[model samples]
Target chain A: MKITDPRTAATGHRVSLAVSLWLSLSVLLALVLISIAVGKYRIGPGELVTALINRLQGGDGEVPTVIETVIFQIRLPRITAAVLVGAALAAAGATYQSLFRNPLASPDILGVSAGAGLGAAAGIFLSLPVAGIQLLAFAFGSFTVLLVYVISRAVRGHDPVLVLVLAGVVMGTLAGSCISLLKYLADPYDQLPAITFWLLGSLNAVNPADMQVSLLLVGLGLVPLYLLRWRMNLMSLGDEEARALGVNAGRLRLVFIMSATLVTASAVSISGVIGWVGLMIPHIARLLVGPDFARLLPTSMLLGAAYLLGVDDLARTIGEVEIPLGILTAFLGAPFFLWLLAHSRRGWQ
Target chain B: MSIDIAGLAFGYPGHPVGSDVSLSVAPGEVLCLLGPNGSGKTTLFKTTLGLLPPLKGRIAVDGETTERWSRRRTAQHLAYVPQQHDAYFPFTVMEVVLMGRGAYVAAFATPGRHDREVAERTLRELHLLHLRDQVYSQISSGERQLTLIARALTQQPRVLIMDEPTANLDFGNQVLVLNQILRLKQAGITIMMSTHDPGQAFYCADNVAMLRDGRLLCWGPTDEVLTSANLRSVYGVDVAVVEITKTGEHPGKVCVPVMSDPRGRADSEIQAPPA
Candidate 1:
């Protein structure tokens, strides 16, 4: 009965969820709007808002053609793609970290990213079209996780999570070798640059069609995660505890792996392998709002969206030529990650 | 409801660790299981909790077969506290305790206000209400064990099964946990726990079961099953059950192992024949 009387530091366990959610959402909105305004064509905030309102009302005739094209055709697809990719990777990463009960577990827990990279590099070496390359990446990514799942299943009665991680490591090394082989075989003049660029990851080639496809797939993947968020928390406590708590740990783990894999594969297919969002955003969200998955999932998604959008904005606006997303993210993420490790004692609670 | 396990066999795949195990605990009774390392005490506990299927026999809970019961229903009847747990995420103590309400909560639903109330009450009952706000991982092992007990209590189960609940604890903390087990027995919870110390059986167990190499060696009232001979037979160590009497305190049994040599002896003395 006297529970609420505690004003101690331990009792201040979490930031108020509603307030954090609202603030993150507001910041995400502001980032999207501001990012649209800051691009090369220089659409002002006022013009952008008016054009958005006009477009929402289906009065496209009032807005100038260039402004309309810049907003809808150029920036909108890129911004939407960035947000979706960021949110998907972060959500999948958080789920992976929880599922494996390893803080080091990333979205590539099943070698999906390595498989995608290998597939994309091979596609580039063979001079495939952009769409063909993306298709190959998606196919290989999903296939790799499926193979990992199959291998883990083959070795029954052992800890499935441990088996999956081991399979992932072995398969990831295999995929990395394939990538190196492809790189070595690629033409030094044209194909090598393309292969390198794709591996480094780019949003420049992401169009409206790619955005639509990824949006649908990421949304589909996210629904089950949102529904099973609390179970994800339970699963993170390890298999025995989760089962003791009345959950079917194996079935739930399979469901989560498939869902997370779908999103990661779709995002990689579109954005080429943008790293760090999946590995770091959940930790940031955990620092903001404890480890309860119900709150952690949404918070990770919002923060990831904003963080990626801001990073992408800098990628496009900082120079004459566009920088790839992967490099910028690693540049920013690695140092921040180190800082997190340094301050971990204060923040983990 | 009391736990009623009969002819239970438990093991991992292709490895039969325990067989022909039979035990029963009545409501308000404390059952202590004594065994050596790898002697199938934990395997039997797991089988009783229905975490593992019995390889040979039937496990019934209050006259109902557990296989016919849903996980949620079984959890409502029986709760388990493992010897140790390492939680990956740093969930607060209260959140960890609230996990015990998972049985009552519907799938896809989070713990509600009523569940929180139960957790709070259980934590308070164990004198852990002040520590509820602390991070679970940051706590001492004794507090962690107590928190786990509080979590089990939140399940409101008729039977509680703990595997070596006092393992790795200081003497004071071991007594603390043992006292809590006694208190739980008084509160009408059917309690079963495993321990290496026979003295604990004498202290708290109403019934005792000794296991050795997948077989139930002895089972009966604590005083009957936990004699010096049974201890030596199960543990391969000679021990004496000595009585302790103190002023204004209840008399208790203390198990003292008979060690021939306190320090390591030279090979010559060790081989110095029957003398």
Candidate 2:
């Protein structure tokens, strides 16, 4: 029997995917350049390149000191943090979504963000320095997921994923309550505002040190995900099917949760509790590239980086006062996400 | 390859669903498991696939104990096709089939060109190459089941364990899947599948195992095991195992339910149709 071949349709899909990837990459590159050039201390493209070249060539002192500092010290670190945090969160979100087999699963679904928020709040209440606060956030974030994992493991004869998610929800709520308690007890004039702002999230305070540390942690997390990208496809099929397909699903899940949590914690540590990017970017990427993790991961990272950088740029330049990134992301992301949901012909399943 | 299950007890930890169950499927033979809901057929299949630890006995593949084998090694010998269900992502048929090559692909690597070739060839064999680019979720239920079968086939396993492959399918699709099962059997692949319908067992199963309440009711060659008495015993409903020997067609068996009054009244108490 002859079947009508849709080979041409398939080829069209392949071509579209390729085009989408290239378009995302180009957008990201353009956003990076725009982010570098359009800051308050507006440096022209020529001056920016010259300053970068001068900095790279052993600080030749040809560029003015103020320009050099703005490019290298302030804007560069903040931009790098934006991209890294964006990519990390999006990657983590995609991982969790796939692992949970739920489109609604986000980077913080496992309580990492809540734990980080609690840790940062505690740090601000204690009047700790920025570095100390970041450290606490990272530590607490990892600890929360570990605690949830242990709790899920302790509960037997239930669906493991459901158990894990439930534990995370419970733990996340507890962490949120703790943060609220901290907020209630803090000195309203100083610590409360600091805690609130930290919770709202910002990249304005990101320094070279924070950028480097997060970069390292995010890279560490992403390597395992990249290596096991193919296997990640089977993970959504659930533990039983994955095992039947020769993947040790339990072990693979552990590896994935740890990796995704590491990236999320690291991103949250430096950037505070930026929301929506993790939850939204992966969906947008899936709409663009379909759900093949090998393609989805990279596409998510690129789009996420571009998205946050663009949002951050707006945060700085859209008004006299810089808006918290969390607010901007929600304000922008929710509507776009809804629009995507309504317009896309593909079902979320 | 052949599979041997000796005194196998299986279930999740702290909950034993079935125990002391034993069965085997020889090379290229089809073994059909017939059971009602919650009778532990799925649990048994999971145990046989090594997804769950056999609580009491052992499962041997090709006469070798598979207790210590890695999941990859187990999958090299066997693959599983789960019931038709919604996939979370809209992966294309080709992508889903390519995932079956996970056992052969390196942990740190994606499926290579050769893996794609195997997936494509499996799809071709199943006549599913035409739907290769179609999203798995968008396909008809029968096509989804076939796609899953193609995935299992791409694993290049000698044995395939399917959990109710015909469940939820319409009549034509059910026959299509059954015909595919027979085709696979003819291709010398061992298949162990569970079915809600005993007639399905009659259709393709060389051997049959009837399960109820976590225990085997009867098991042997299909004709010997799937009698009307066995069906009534297992399902608590009377059914006549009828043979149809239509001319110019292969003889087949079908289970026709013998309905009774729902009020527990004897047939004689009901007003009979005017003679």
Candidate 3:
């Protein structure tokens, strides 16, 4: 007999729910504060806080030029971009896991991320503006998952698990080849650097406009899920069982995939294809508070925001030159992946 | 609305599991299908649910063939609890049960207040109210069965089909699942289950359907079809159809052990003291 309280089975109690929530929020807040503190130009801690306070107050007439530049122009946009991208990735991860009913399933399981990365790179090599690249990334990323869904439905398996995953792999490879072709055709010095930077992933180019478009659509996609978290909970059961209970498995899956894709595409648009956050964030979230989606969604959002922000911080300041955020995440995240693979009784589900 | 099974045959691609089966479940009645291993019991249930297409005949719910109604509409009137559910995701017990409202909810619409309440009540009925928040993967076998039943209850279905609902449960949980079925029957739900255990079926089932070699051997009131003679023919084995004969202070169980005697084994084991 399945029980509701996760604490009673295999893990700690619901009380840990509160602790996880608090920990996520505190880490997110700390990351935000730390992110606000660092940049190409550093502002004194007190002055930074003062500038932030002044900026928020809209009375920043006499602020020091150094503090003003750091807070208003450089740090504010990057920090906002980091938090939003992280939250979106983590939320997309949780959504993908639920939609596919596999713990090892990630947003890229349906080739969405890879498709978007290829689109962004192609846009850059073709001399599309930064905004056009963002748009292309969002469109192609969402399109990849949609294509996977349609093909899987038409293909051999009615169950979209392995079919979609395999379809994703195929599409991802095709997109990757297209990206290679674009690289071969590019002006070596200019477009090669552009495509390479886009591939490695960075937060250097995210602006308020990209963030705004993503925030609006991605937030809309997430709200319905948050409100219908209980339904998402039902969706985790096998379709046969779930339908016997009354869930329309096909319709709900479509909704879930589209919604997850929306957020994932948006995140990709802003972050330029950070690899591991979406794959790993929800797993850590599950480890923290179990899988009740109401708790799980919020926990992922918080941890994802915190984690990505922290990783970006290290990426920006750890060396004299900026390293791509994806490299930093892969460094910290791949070992966790290998550990999860080695120890988790069921690996890469 | 009774479930009418008329001359139905079903099986996998290369194996002909069962055929020429006819049965019905009256409103508020419990029907038990008894069969040995490889008896096509699961296939019969699947055909009725329209999960697998029947090769020979038809299954009707409320006097109409299953094909006449939309799956959702048919599903609204009936629910099934699978023999086992290891194929689920990491959803919660409450969430699992709440999926019973799937057909009722509009496309892309969330579950409303009534749906949540129904799920909660279903959990309460299964004595799983305390387990509503638990993740699905970590639950015990018995609890898993109850959770499935709770999901069925959330459907508010009129006909309930279960395939070996007690296969994983111990004796206590077997009783527990049957008790829930009995409760569903009393609420005017027609219940059908393929069970291997005869003793449990004798008490709970209004009718018993027996299958062998893809054919219905016999089906009728439980007492009529569950006789020792019929049991022997169906199973082709020696079995004691025990009976109670109470006499004063010393009660006796009249052990009717099978007598496949070479001679008239009246004194068969009586004179043999050592093996």
Candidate 4:
């Protein structure tokens, strides 16, 4: 009866979450629209807003055809890609935390993003087109998770922790080596630039077609986990307890592994292996709200989208040359993760 | 609610830890499975709960074979509280308890209003209502044990199976867990547990199953099965079974040898010499 009371949290918790969610989403929304306005062509907020309005309503579209093309064709796709990628990364991170029952678990740290990058690089070195590169990335990303699961299964009985982490580092290093090999083998004229750009990770390459792929991949993969959210929450308690609760750990883990990597691979394929969004966003979500999975997963999705949008804007606007989204996210995310680590230390102790 | 194990065997691929272990449990009964380290108490619990498929034998809960049921369905019928869990993230007590409702909802759906009420009532029953908001891992070991039990209670199972549920707690906490279990038994819940503590076997258990060398040495009423002779044989040591004045009927004190010194193996009663 007490739990059914809508106000589970006191006034303070409700107020803080409401304020934070509103503030974060609003700031993120503003930055996205404004970033759409100020590109290499340098349109102001008014022109950007008018163009977006017209594009939605239909007509001369708003600005000149070229300007409209720049906004609609180029900048819009990139900004949308950033938000989707961010949301996917954060959602994947939260899923990983439940998968491994460790907050430190993330797509990159577990080597999935690395494997995806390696796959993309392989595609590039082989001179495959962009669509082919996306395929390669998803394939490699999925393979990495399977191998981790296999190795963890092999070394059963010992805590799944050490074996899993070891497998990630070993596989990640192997994937990194493959990336190095691709970089070395690439033709300097045509192939090298593509491989290099893929490694750096950018929204500069994303367009409507890529956005469509992003939507398809992330949408399908996310639905299962979202529907299975309560099961995932039960699972986070640890394997035996979950089994005791009547969950098939093997099946659930397989579903989560495949699905979480689906989102990661899509994000990786389109945006080229952005880091930290997954790892840090879950921690931040947990701190704001306690670790209730129902609350935590949805909140992580929203905040991750908003946070990545803001970060990508800064990436675009920092200087004459734009910083890679991956580098910018890492720059911001790693410290927040560390700060959380320090804060969690006292509470756990 | 009751359990029927025709024959149960468990172990790794090459190394079978237990075999031909037959047992049963009836409602309002506390059954304690006792064995030394590596004798297969934990393994038996896993097999019974269907976490690990038994290498041999059949386990039936409420007259139906375990293999017949879905994991969720089986989980709804029986609940287990494990030895000691150390999760890196300290989900709150309510959050932990709410996990017991895993079987009541559609896979992946949030626990509905009724599920939450069950969890709350379970926690309240365990005297953990005030502590529900506290992080589980941050709680004292005694409280953690109680919280885990509360979580199991929320499953609304007819039978409760636990593996050394009070292992990490101190003496006072041990009493609390045992007392709570007794109350659950009074409510007609069938109880099964594996514990190394002999005092617990006689003090609270209605039936005792002693395991040795992957075999069921005995399974019957507590007084008949957990004799000083049985303890000596299984553990390869001497034991002094002392009757407590508080409960004259049940043997409450069991003094076991430190390292199983075979030097003083008296024929009839193998026990601590003089002292």
The per-candidate TM-score of the B chain, in the order shown, comes to: 0.93, 0.94, 0.86, 0.90
lDDT of 4 by residue, A243-298 (tens): 88978877887788778888888888888978788888887777766566666677
**Which pairs of residues have clashing backbones in candidate 1?**
none
Candidate 2 regions with alpha-carbon error over 4 angstroms: A1-18, A45-64, A344-349, B261-275
Candidate 2 vs candidate 3: which has greater DockQ?
2
In CAPRI terms, model 1 is classed as acceptable
Best by DockQ: 2
Q: Clashing residue pairs, candidate 4?
A: B7-B57
Candidates 1 onward: DockQ, in order: 0.49, 0.62, 0.33, 0.45
Q: On residues A1-349, what C-alpha lDDT tens digit does candidate 2 reach at each position?
A: 9776554253234435578789988998888888888878898999988987887888878899988888778888998999999999999999998999988899999999999999999999999999999999999999999999999999988999999999999999999999999999999999999999999999999889777778898999999999999899999898888999999999999999999999999999999999989888998788778888988899999889999999999999988889999999999978977887787664363
DockQ for candidate 3: 0.33
Q: Kindly list the per-residue Cα lDDT of model 3 for residues A114-197, writing each as its tens digit.
A: 889888987887799988888898888888888888888888524556687788889888888988888899899999888888
Give the better candidate number (1 or 2) by lDDT: 2
* Index of the highest-lDDT prediction: 2
iRMS, model 4 (angstroms): 4.2
Error of 1 at A199 (Å): 1.8
Clash statistics: count for each candidate: 0, 0, 15, 1
Q: Quick one: best TM-score, which candidate?
A: 2
List lDDT for all candidates, in order.
Answer: 0.87, 0.90, 0.78, 0.80
Error of model 3, residue B189, in angstroms: 3.1
Interface RMSD values, listed in order for every candidate: 2.3, 2.4, 4.2, 4.2
